[model samples]
Target: MDVRTGLFYLFSVVLLFAAFRVITARNPVYAALYLVLTFFRASGIWLLLRAEFPAITLVLVYVGAVMVLFLFVVMMLDIDVDALRAGFWKHFPIAASVGALIALEMAAVLMGGFRASEEPRALPGVAAAAQAGVQFSNTKELGKLLYSEYLYPLEIAAVLLLVAIIAAIALTLRHRKDSKQFDPAQAVRVRASDRLQVIKVAPTRPAAPPAAPDTPAAETK
Candidate 1:
């Protein structure tokens, strides 16, 4: 095929591989790195689609910010892979069902997009601007669409993100029996004696006087 199509396929293949590795990799750090790769490939695909804003945003937002944070957390945390996977077989059926449902939904959406027969129709203003040969900004148009048509969905997404942030904080801040939590106020007010102790014992015995070394006897001459 042409160069664009070739690049698209290349990015798609790498993206799929990286996405798969994100889920299957045993090391969490490797998984996060793979996810970063997935985002980069996705951004490249978006660039090929001529959606520059989305491509840049994907790289800057997800790759630069989110993936860095994910990598930091994954690397810092002592993740118990065995304990985490202990219930995997027990939960496999439900997880499989949910995954299948999501796959079906994605298939449906892709099928509908492919089946669309009509050419993409731009907004009336955008069409007029195009006819007049006025420079158009897709980013501006996207902003308008987000603030107008998709406002509710955008607000809902923000709320959901906020809820997720709160939930994560709640989970992290939860008290654990095994954790050695200390009160800062109590620690600050403590006396040195509470934290340290010094004891004196009588000397085992008085210091012995130094013994004088005998001079070597002069060689019998």
Candidate 2:
């Protein structure tokens, strides 16, 4: 096989293995790590397919940002493996059936003799430039298309993601009575006198002993 085809198969194999491990691994952290590995291999496969923009985006956005966040979250969570596995047998039949169906569907799709109707026609300028072995700027082309044609959808998606991130932070953060939290604005405006108060009080002397006179008068009478 050609080098490209060989590399494709290699990356595909690793991707599949990593994806399998993501589900089957007992440790949640390990599962998250395996998922990150799957993303990395998938990105590599995309790179091989000449989809450099998507490949780099996949690595930067998913592998770098999302997966790292997932890893941190998974690591922070106190997952009890035994508790999680308690209902494994109970759910096994349904889960197994679903898994089997998915596997069968994938197998059918891959094995089915589905051929492309036609080789993809490159853009008017793209084909000529490609033939000259000149590197085409996929990122630039994608940016143009996205901003020009899909700007509204892209902006909406960005706003949605921003809302989701804020929601996630709000949900994860809690007000704890024991934990000390300070508002930055309040802190910045605070005066030294407001923060510290010193009071001077005159010290009181102890009451003098007065009981000795009563016994002396009784003895004289």
Candidate 1 residue 104 Cα shift, in angstroms, is 0.7
User: Stretches of candidate 2 above 4 Å error?
Assistant: 107-134, 156-180, 186-221
**How does residue 36 of candidate 1 score in lDDT?**
92
How does each model score on TM-score?
0.62, 0.67
Q: What are the per-model C-alpha RMSD values against the true structure? A: 8.6, 7.7
> For residues 21-79, could you state the per-residue lDDT of candidate 2 as single tens digits?
98899999889889889988999998887888889888899989998898888788887
Per-residue CA lDDT of model 1 for 1-221, tens digit only, reads: 99999999999999999999988898889999999999999999998876789999999999999999988898889999989879878999999999999999999887866666857767786788899999877778889999999999999999999999999999987889998777779988999889899889977988899998766674433
Candidate lDDT (C-alpha), each: 0.90, 0.88
Error of 2 at 165 (Å): 6.6
Residue-pair clashes, model 1:
0
